[model samples]
Target chain A: MKLLEEGIPLAELSIERIARTAGVGKAAIYRRWSGKEELFVDVVRSAEPADPELPGTSMRADLVVLLETQRQRGVFSRQSVILHNVHAQMKSSPKIWAAYQNTVIAPRRRLGLEVLRRGQSNGELRDDVDIELLYDLFVGPMLVRSVLRPDGDLPDGLAERIVDTLLEGLRPVSSRPG
Target chain B: MKLLEEGIPLAELSIERIARTAGVGKAAIYRRWSGKEELFVDVVRSAEPADPELPGTSMRADLVVLLETQRQRGVFSRQSVILHNVHAQMKSSPKIWAAYQNTVIAPRRRLGLEVLRRGQSNGELRDDVDIELLYDLFVGPMLVRSVLRPDGDLPDGLAERIVDTLLEGLRPVSSRPG
Candidate 1:
């Protein structure tokens, strides 16, 4: 990651070079990670912020915390060159991306599903729609700003704003309550 | 695109090669596009489906059209090897990504904003939030399914489902009206 942060393209990062840089033998690297792709996957997972502890206060709060984690990651990722290189490399190399997806994305998705299930049982979320679809509604916008759009900003309060807006819906109030 | 679809990597694509493949002179390619990046951008734009003409029936209807276009594109892109290569290359090359964003993403964004604004004026949407925020809420979910999540599916009626659910709100109703 330090090498990636310094703009070392993932392609140029050989295990031997990595071991040398770390003052270790190549055997040390091969012992833990079979190859560069596997090593890259581990690096991304390690760098990612741990999943948030749900507040268990309410569905909205839990969702906010989940999104806030993404928000912070987005902010940091933008400031670093590693993500850009890693992301491009991951896409270019399907094996690394698959490993990353199975390890990182799948677990995060399960966490989201758990929260939505809790929301459903507690009467915090509308249960008429498919739960997976509901989860996408909650998580997608923040990700758009956080991951997809390079220019998207993760301003303070964005997580709360997203949750509140989705809960409240975009429908104009029949009459302004205030 | 032919080369890309056949699994030729972008790094190996050169104007001379492209011209040779197309049976055109290098000067002919240069006269049309400033460089390989510009030509690649043109190819992407040309390949992208034409933007949908809004139905002008209601905000819900219009939004469905917009999202449906994305859904179709998503489905097509997943099937095309060209996209996998182009997408990776685009992200790797800042210059190409910038040009693609400016020409493709910018106009798409403007269309989204326009639709959202119209919805607000017609009392179909809440005016309290910033319009851009509102736009993000509507577009973000579909994009997540369409762009960010590689395994996400774009089934029929997904556009309507997203639009309707968003308009209806996710808050549990005080009582089930149905």
Candidate 2:
């Protein structure tokens, strides 16, 4: 993981490097994993976001917390670096891509969907709101901003602003008469 | 461009193939551009969205039209294929990366920002709205959805829904009164 964060291409990573970095012998690594890809896949699986404890707060507050946690977990972190490397190599490595998606990407998405579903059940969101689309709207800005300006810091209160905008949009129509 | 859309790797794209595909000799291609990357960059530059005639319409209408146009231009098109290929190769190919960003990404963003600024001046949007952040909020959901489910079709009325949500959020607090 350290070597990956240092931007070493996955194909160039070796058992010798891993063993040396961990102060272990090559035999030790070989005993556990057959090759570099397997070892790296295991490293990524370990970094998956655990199912978060939902705050059970208002939809807006829950979404703010979710986006904030995604930012902390994904942006400017070793996990993010690994995710990028895996994505870049996805076309060539199907097995690793599936593991990455199932472990890293899917879990986060499931958590977001669960939060939206809770909001719907509680009558905070409109009955017609598309939870899938709503989920993307809530997190898309931060994700794109991170990619476009990886070195730049996010503006203050971005999470709150995104949630506020989305909640206002999702309000039941009858509640806001002209 | 046809060859690229057919899934040929850029590095494997040949002048002979292009010439054969276009029913011209390799000499014809070389006369216009030096190499594949330069030729592709030129194709991308030609595809950049022109300065759209803003209808000077309401912010909701303007944004919906803008996003719909972007979807038409970007999703599942030859232009999008070229853009993705260039982005993937960006780190190793700085010149092509710069050309792609300058030609494609920047122009679209400028147009969107212009619309938001117009909204603010006309008092349709809150004066405190962050135009840059607002731009991302409007486009991010569509962009991320396209990436996450490239094979899945967008739901009906997606553009209208996104614009409606954003406008409601951007409406002045004093106007809502609730």
Candidate 3:
């Protein structure tokens, strides 16, 4: 993991090189993992922040925690050079990118879907909106700030603000006559 | 454009190579553009779909058009391998990426902002919410599907759906004991 953080391209990394750098025998690594690919998958998993233990108070509360996890990750991704490089390098290796997607992104997406599903069921969310679009609508802004527009600020209260804002929306309510 | 669409890594491409490929002299190319980076920037700009001549209509109508433009782009990006490769290649070349951002991305961002600012002023949007967040909220889901989650569907009517959904919001209207 340290070796990768140094921006060593994954293609150039070998188990023997890793062992030599760490002053350990190659056999030690082989005994723990099948190969570098397996090891790398593990390393990235360890590096990623774990999913939040939801509050279970309400779907709203649960979503706040979920998006907060994304906010924390956004902070981490911006700060962690190791993580930034791993994602960049992973894209270059199609096999590794696919593996990472299956292992990391897919599961996370499923977890998000499940939350929206529950919210719809509980009448917290409107059932008319497609649950998948709802998930993207809720999650997309943080991601836009995190990934697409680097200049966009991620200030504190972002998670709550995003959830609350989406829950209510940007349109001004009409002032109905009493 | 043809040269780039061929998937030749930009680093491996040169003015001379481009000229030769196009069956033109290097001097002819140089006569028009100063250098490769400048030429590359223009090629990408031309390749991108032109922005909509927004209907001088209500904010909701205009916003729907703006998002609909994004939806069109989302469609183009998915279909055009050239676009996908250009975006990927641009990321690898910091200088070109900066140039692209300046020429291509920055103006589009301003346009989106201007529309939102107008909406806020004209009572289409809530004055209390940050305009930037509002911009991202409207634009983010389309972009998320466009750039982040490729498997996330970008079906027809997505622009209208996102706009209408956001305008009203996801939270179900309270039953007023009618």
Candidate 4:
């Protein structure tokens, strides 16, 4: 993991080199994983915390946790360097790539949907808001911005603003106070 | 340029290879540009069109052009692939790096400022919309979305919906119609 976090390209890795650096015998390393790619995949899998338990709460609180998880990974974690390398490697390796999509991306998206579904049930979000379409709108822009400006100022309170604005526009118009 | 659009790694480039591909001599290639890096930089420089002229009409019209430009680049263009490679290369090459900052990113930001300034002058946007911050808000999210889901479905009328929502929130509270 440290090797990958240091911007090492995963494709060029060798098991012997990993074992040498770790002060272990090649047999010990080979006993644990099939190859360097599997070892690298294991390292990535170990980075994510256990799946967060979604609380039965208000939409704002639920979404804040969800968005914060993304922000931490997307903006604040050391894993970003690993994610970049993994993103590049996914173009070439299918096994590692499937692990990434399933472990990293799918769960985060599932949480977003859960929050939206909760909001709909509670009447805080509109019945008309397409949960799937709203998910795209909610997530798409931030991912695009991060790509363009990896270290640039993330609009402070962006998730809050998006949620607030969308909720405002989506509420039953007559229910809105002046 | 086509090679980059096809996901060819810039690190793998060689002058002899490029020349053979282009059906030109090494001298002919060197005559046009010093190296593959310079040639690739030239490709990025060539693709940027002059900023669309603002029509000095409503903020909606002026902003429609600006937001649409962002959407096109953020979502549709192969320019993003070059943009990503430029960022990755900046970690290594300082000279090609500095040129990218001054040329590609800074100019687009300045163009954004001009559009916002026009919005304030024409009374379409609120007097206190914070042009610099608004630039970040308007442009940042679209880029974030693109990087995350390069091939995801663009929600129907998503662009117009964003513009409408922003227009509503940014307008003076008193200006909002029932």
Candidate 5:
């Protein structure tokens, strides 16, 4: 992971390097994984966040927490390198791509869906909200920004602002009785 | 552009093939542009939509039109291939990257910002709306979706739905009277 974060090409990730980095024997690494790709997948899978504790509070708070977690994960050192590499290789390396989607993308999407579902069930979100589109709205900007401006910092309170805007859009008209 | 849409790698974009395909001599192409990179940039620049005429009927309509244009430009044959290529090469080919950003990305973003500014002036959106964030909200989903599901079709009325969600969230609360 450190090597990847430092922007090492995926092709350069050798078993010897991993063994040396982790202070393990090459034999130990070989016993558990077939190759660098498999080992890389395992490292990413291990980084998946455990099932998030739902805030069970307001939809705004729940969404804020959810997006904040995503932001933190993305902003972490070297994760962006891993993400960029996987995205670039999605077409050329189906196996690695599948592993990345299954281990990283799918789980995060599922967690987001769960939060949106909770919002809908609690009458905080409009019944018609498209769960998939809503999920994209929640995290798409951060993802795009990360790609376009790798070194740029997001404005403070961006997560809160995204939640506020989305919730404002999602709330039923009748519910906002002033 | 045709060759790129057909998924030719940038390295494979040859002046001889381009000349043959376009029914022109290789000398003719070289006489106009210094090299393939410059020619490719010009081709992309020519494809950019001229300043889009805003309907100004409503924010929702304006946003729908804006996003629809983005979708069309993205979905046009193999523009995605062009986009992916440019993105992948941004680090290695700063000149091409700058040209792409100037010709493709910056113009579209400028158009979006203009529309949002209009909305704010017309009292269709809150003065406090973060224009940059709003811009992302309008197009981020589509961008992310296009990348992730290159072949998956968006549901009908997706443009409308995205606009609806964003407008609902962005309209000033006080403006919506019971």
Candidate 6:
């Protein structure tokens, strides 16, 4: 990830190259991982930052912290390439697909549920909100932005705006209590 | 889309078969469009519905109609497919991607902005919310839910929950004067 994060394109990579770069023998690399694609997936899965604490504070503050830390490294920055490769490869390989589901999608879903549950119990989130559906709200926009505008950066405060809009509602309505 | 919406997989598609099914000559299809891929893109685009009209009522009603109508057919659903295909093709060819962005992405962005602007003018939306970023909030979750959990169907009353949680604020405190 450190290598990919620094903009190492995977097309230029090889198992032999990775071995040399990591200061290990080619045979040693082969014994553990079958090839470059597998190695790349391993790199991504093992390298993702540990999930952040849910904080149990105000939902705003907790969510703000949850997103900001991710922004520091850029969400799915390096993993985007791996994801592209994996999605295509999965067309032909079930094992790769399973690995991706388990390693990538499952963990994120679990973490999202954890935060939402914490927010609910702490009175920082709505009791009626479906945590899973809400997780889609938390993640969907950033993913769309990344897909649509790959070259465009996630502009400053965009994450906060997303969190705000999702929590507060984007509907234009008078707040008066009539 | 009828095919896909009916659960036919992409892997099952063939040029001759699709042309036969649609009652067009294979050569006629090829002369205007290169292959099934281009034909599919055009089919989706041409079928996209116009944007929903915004009633000048409460913001919540306006947003609900906007969201629910978006699900009716066309635009968002078709655009989502285009985005998925574009992302997938990004790894393989630049040409397909450029076509996808030009035909699908730009138009969607424009439509989303229009929705946000209308909300703002009616005093139903926050003056501080960035329109473009707000567009992200509006469209992101819908697309994400479609892509990740194609079968999970957006749950009952989920849209209302999203609006209430976001607009009313998720904080437990009673800030509004009693």
Please list the residue runs of candidate 1 whose C-alpha ends up more than 4 Å from where it truly belongs after superposition: A5-8, A12-20, A23-36, A175-178, B3-8, B11-35, B175-178
Predicted complex 4: CAPRI docking category? incorrect
lDDT against true structure, model 2: 0.68
lDDT agreement of model 4 with the native? 0.62
What is the C-alpha lDDT profile of model 3 across B20-43, one tens digit per residue? 998999999999988888889888
Candidate 3, fnat value? 0.73
**Candidate 6: docking tier:** acceptable
Compared with the true structure, what per-residue lDDT tens digits does model 2 show for residues B37-57?
678777655654543565766
Best by DockQ: 3
Comparison by TM-score, 1 against 5, better one: 1
Q: Please, what is the whole-model Cα lDDT of each candidate in the order they appear?
A: 0.86, 0.68, 0.83, 0.62, 0.69, 0.62
TM-score of predicted structure 1:
0.89
Q: Pick the candidate with the highest lDDT.
A: 1
TM-scores of the candidates in the order shown: 0.89, 0.74, 0.91, 0.67, 0.77, 0.67
- Range of the 10 consecutive residues with the lowest summed lDDT in candidate 4 chain B: B168-177
Interface RMSD of 4: 7.4
Clashing pairs in 5: A5-A78
TM-score of chain B of 5: 0.69
Among all candidates shown, the one with the greatest TM-score? 3
lDDT of 3 at B76: 83
For candidate 3, list the clashing residue pairs, or say none.
none
The runs of at least 3 residues in candidate 2 whose Cα sits more than 4 Å from the true structure, single-residue gaps closed, are: A2-8, A12-39, A45-53, A78-87, A90-92, A148-153, A169-178, B2-8, B12-38, B45-54, B78-92, B151-153, B169-177
Candidate with more favorable, higher DockQ: 4 or 6:
6
For residues A1-178, what per-residue lDDT tens digits would candidate 1 score against the true structure?
A: 7787778877788998899888999999999988888898989877767778888898888999999999998888787677656776787777888888887889999999999999889998988899889989998999999889878968999999999888887888773332
How large is the i-RMS for each model, in angstroms? Answer: 4.3, 5.7, 3.5, 7.4, 5.6, 3.4
Model 5 vs. true fold: TM: 0.77
Model 4 lDDT per residue over B28-48, tens place: 999988776677666766665
Taking the tens digit of each residue's C-alpha lDDT, what string does model 4 give over A90-160?
A: 64576776666665677778878877777767765554545765565555545544544556545567666
